[model samples]
Target: MYLTSSRPDIVHTTCLCARYQAKPTENYLKEVKMIFCYLWGTINTGLWYTKDSGFELTGFSNAYYAGCKDTFKSTSDGAQFLGEKLVIWSSKKQDCTALSTAEA
Candidate 1:
């Protein structure tokens, strides 16, 4: 669970699995392993702090209409960075259903 602090990308997935930490089932364990595999595959993309880099903050975001097939809800995600390192990020389903793509 502590891994979520520095690895925002896996926060939601980790949190879901954490809910069953007391008596996790085989499915939950499989999910946890997948998370670790994902981390390993993206090892080089990790944030690294280094001296001499300028402290410039930047953010990017995107939303797609009806992106989630299961809920038919718009999904949005964002990432914030400080110089070369990511400081924050999030992905979530919107609360309201959109009437059209424009509304989403």
Candidate 2:
């Protein structure tokens, strides 16, 4: 949830990985363990919202065409922010295939 809320660009890949969370295979488990290891190695890393950071808001969004192999669904990604502080991010696969980028 943190990653999804802080970095929308990773949502497609994260959700794709999450789909296998219910019945994780050995490969998926290994990947998850690797993430844990990475987290352990980066324990000192942190995000800071400084007082000097102005409260300017900005956002960006994007999508990939047919990113899901199983569903052939287009993935949408977006992020919202207040000043330099990230407020929200999301990535989700659409229920229907988009005929074009405009349709999406």
Top-TM-score candidate index: 2
TM-score of each: 0.60, 0.74
Q: Kindly list the per-residue Cα lDDT of model 2 for residues 1-104, writing each as its tens digit.
A: 46655434445556777878888789878876776676677666655677888788999888888777777778887877788877777788888998877767
Give the clashing pairs for model 2.
none
lDDT of 2: 0.73
Cα distance off (Å), candidate 1, residue 24 = 12
Q: Write the per-residue lDDT of candidate 1 for residues 1-104, one digit (tens) a residue.
A: 67787788897677557756898889989999999999999887766778876699999987778866546878677888888778788766788988898887
Q: Which ten residues in a row have the lowest lDDT in candidate 2?
A: 4-13
Worst 10 residues of 1 by lDDT: 11-20
Q: How close is candidate 1 to the true structure, as a TM-score?
A: 0.60
